[model samples]
Target: MQAQRKMRIAHYGRKPVKIYGKTTQIDSSLMANTTQEEKRCSFITLNSDPLYVAYHDEEWGVLVHDDKMLFELLVLTSAKVGMDWTSILRKRHDFRAAFARFDTKIVANFTERQIASVATNCNLDLKKV
Candidate 1:
């Protein structure tokens, strides 16, 4: 006799979705019904992970020359070691709050106590850049 496929349940917002197969928990919002190339460039193949898609489509290789933006990117990139970029993207708001919104001069002149406080609060291993 043949074995029947098992089903799983997952929630999308408040609606319960019946899922099957190894990966069937789909988010309809992210599915635009576009071709693979239309979704992103050839370099990005992490279509299953939304953060990677967002990074590739929205922020990857974009020219950033502003001091504040540059500082923010620097801080985020510093925290990217050992942790995934998805986590970094998720914690971006918290990082800005903790790091004085990445104001270059403010961050540059940060007291050791303040730096220590932010590090402890955010639990981020930041590189000195």
Candidate 2:
């Protein structure tokens, strides 16, 4: 059996339209015009900070099923306790560098000396797991 095709919306200009039948269907007259207010009110607001807002909008709330990503978030969130997220966010690069990039197999093998070294650093507030 063949899978059924789903109808999709296409944008001729600014408006979302669905082409149906022999005649091209214009979904609405509103597509030709858009106001700044309308744009701002869109589901995903584009008017945001390039760095912080982009990460928040794209990756912040998105679900993660990958083990590496899960471990990274875990380490980051744990390291962030009693501290501001901004500080943790800023030091994320350093954390990756120091922690071997959250490789589960590698971090799982960390010795007490390794954990102690990372915890003593001014940049990281590592906790012994």
Candidate 3:
């Protein structure tokens, strides 16, 4: 779908708005009256962070049918016990290696020694897993 035009609450000239007890000019020419859906589609989110915006635009709320992808998501989610999503995304490669590339069978068959190795070498929080 085509992205809607971006809009901001800008004001100027004769129109003064009370913002935080300060009088600010409101620019009516740039004002936009958009539907909720249009606003949502225009930007990934209200967040201004580029990485967060990219993540929301590209992967947020998307379906996963592939086993590998779902497994990756599972590991990522599990690892977010005390960490944030940006940290988890940055550590994706470490997670994949720690979890045997997220192969369901391989991960399931991890030996005690392998588990220990992962705990020692990776930043993963096994307590959460």
Candidate 4:
């Protein structure tokens, strides 16, 4: 005798979706029918913070061709070691201003006093600075 498998239905704003065992099977047509607001990536959907959502949609995974912008991304990624991306992005403006908009030459010229000032103003970790 074979055991009968139970199926479940889940609602997702537009329609009732069928769930079978451990997997969910969605129709290709259903995906096409979903609105833009309903078609976001899982991470963005999970967080839903406006700034984070915008970053995911606009910046995350996009290639950077500008030298200064690449430097900015490198600095921000380094700063994210012990922190969450949300907090890092929240302070992005402060970081930009403090780091001379991530201009490589200008930042290389920052003196000890300037570094300390930027660190204090941006509340950045000294070791990371």
- TM-score, every prediction: 0.61, 0.57, 0.60, 0.66
Which candidate comes out best when scored by TM-score? 4
What is candidate 4's lDDT per residue for 1-129, written digit by digit as tens? 011110111122233334455554544443444454554555567547899888876677554679999999988887787888989999999999999999999999999999889878877787864
Error at 17, model 2, angstroms: 25
Candidate 3 regions exceeding 4 Å error are: 1-49
Q: Give the 10-residue window scoring lowest on summed lDDT in candidate 4.
A: 1-10
lDDT computed for candidate 2: 0.59
**Which residues of candidate 2, in runs, are more than 4 Å off?**
1-50, 122-129
Let me know the TM-score candidate 1 reaches against the reference structure: 0.61
lDDT by residue (1-129, candidate 3, tens digit) is 122234331111124546679986644545456443343444445664567556654566555568999989987888788887887777778988888788999988989999889877767667777
Residue 106 in model 1: lDDT: 81
**Clash pairs (backbone) in predicted model 1:** none
In candidate 4, stretches whose alpha carbon ends up further than 4 angstroms from where it belongs are 1-39
Which digits, one per residue and each the tens of the lDDT, describe model 1 over residues 26-96? 45544434444444555567454787777766666555558888888878888887887878888888999
Models ranked on lDDT: 4, 3, 1, 2
In model 3, residue pairs whose N, Cα or C atoms come closer than 3 Å (at least 3 residues apart or on different chains), thus clashing, are 10-27, 11-25, 11-26, 11-27, 12-26, 12-27
C-alpha RMSD values across all candidates: 14.6, 11.1, 14.2, 11.1
Q: Residue 93 error for model 4, in Å?
A: 0.9
State residue 40's C-alpha deviation in candidate 2, in Å.
Answer: 10
